[model samples]
Target: MIRQIFLALTLAAATALPVAAERIGDAARGATLFDRQCKACHQIGDGATNRVGPTLSNIFGRKAGTVAGFKYSKSITRMGADGLTWTLQTLDAYIENPKALVSGTRMNYRGMADASARADLMAFLRDYSDQPANIPESEPTARKSEPTLDPAILAIQGDPEYGAYLSSECSTCHRRDGADEGIPAITQWPPEDFVVAMHAYKSKLRPHPVMQMMASRLSNDEIAALAAYFATLE
Candidate 1:
């Protein structure tokens, strides 16, 4: 009887796992993820301005590629003219892989492969936008349909060449060959160490505003590639 009860409990827990996983994007957590991923190229909230990308202050419901004075790729502009709005679903899909959705966009970062991460990002964007939308704590239908990837898995599969490409923005402050006065030399470090240090900055475990801000924009794969690249630099 006890064995049967134990089996039933295990099965019940297993059944509940997917539902719990579906509510993956916590808004607070999303805020952190957003800081790390989108803060560099884009700005959101009051007094926002166009930087490398347009201000995302009131992105949802706005037609794509329509922000005044900020240039967009032909594909994005065409899509906007064709009636593209930045709804949560649409943003989620595009965030997964921008080029896949719009062929000529100039946004350089690779698409996020993790559905949960994308969802979290969506939540953050929604919260900060001028008009926010309510996303449920959990959605049974969407949870079952969407596939997810763990960040750890993506990091393990990082590509060094891509890391080298992404490192261009980083090179301005972080010297490639050696350390500047205060900036420690990242060259010749172990890949794992590099990842950990970056995560520390991203999580605010380490406290340099610039480093935290810079580390916030990196995805796991990008981070992995950067780690690999820097590890091999010496």
Candidate 2:
């Protein structure tokens, strides 16, 4: 009888250990981190507007790049077309590394490297987002293969010298040395990143009317040249 009791207690304790080990992020801690890192470009909750990025309320389960007036890169909108929906899993991966998940994404953030911090931030975001009754148990770990760029867009040899001349329009809003104001900094970014952004704007996949209009005026070659120019700036 005593042996049976001991075995039962051991089993119960073993089961309870796993449950205790689980890490449900603290939402309050996440709120603090969000204010420090994300508030510059994004807003959430009551009376948010489209700043450098979109307001992130009700973001979960929504199609990517479909946030009304907020402009999104073509890469993101295309992901939406491919049936990408923002869930806690996907958002965690995205927050961890935007470029890894979506190459050519116009969001310039490198990503949050801390796993615990990411969980905390996600918890906070989940509070604001239209969360499902039950969140998924796993993170989205697989990265989708990046699509190929248009051959014409890829073939153009960007002339950095010519690009310098074309950069006048860009300089009006974007600081050449990459300072962070309300508008994002474009200086010293990868050339492809610049090209991808311009093409997204040109195609209206990113729905900023002013950017669309500006991008429309340039040919693919000109866009490449502009990318080259901006990439060289430090």
C-alpha TM-scores of all predictions: 0.47, 0.49
Model 1 per-residue lDDT tens digits across residues 60-98: 767999999999999999999999887666777688788
Which candidate wins on lDDT? 2
Compared with the true structure, the alpha-carbon lDDT of candidate 2 equals: 0.73
The per-residue C-alpha lDDT of model 2 at residue 165 equals 90
Off by over 4 Å in 1: 1-24, 130-234
Q: Cα deviation of 26 in candidate 1 (Å)?
A: 1.2
Candidate 2 per-residue lDDT over residues 1-234, each given as its tens digit: 112211222323333332212333678999999999999999999999989999888776688899999888999999988987886557777887899888979998989877668778877876776433455533322221122256577677799998999999888998887887888898887888788777656655455678879987999889999888888887
User: RMSD, model 1, all Cα superposed?
Assistant: 20.9
The clash numbers for all candidates, in the given order, read 4, 0
lDDT of 2 at 94: 87
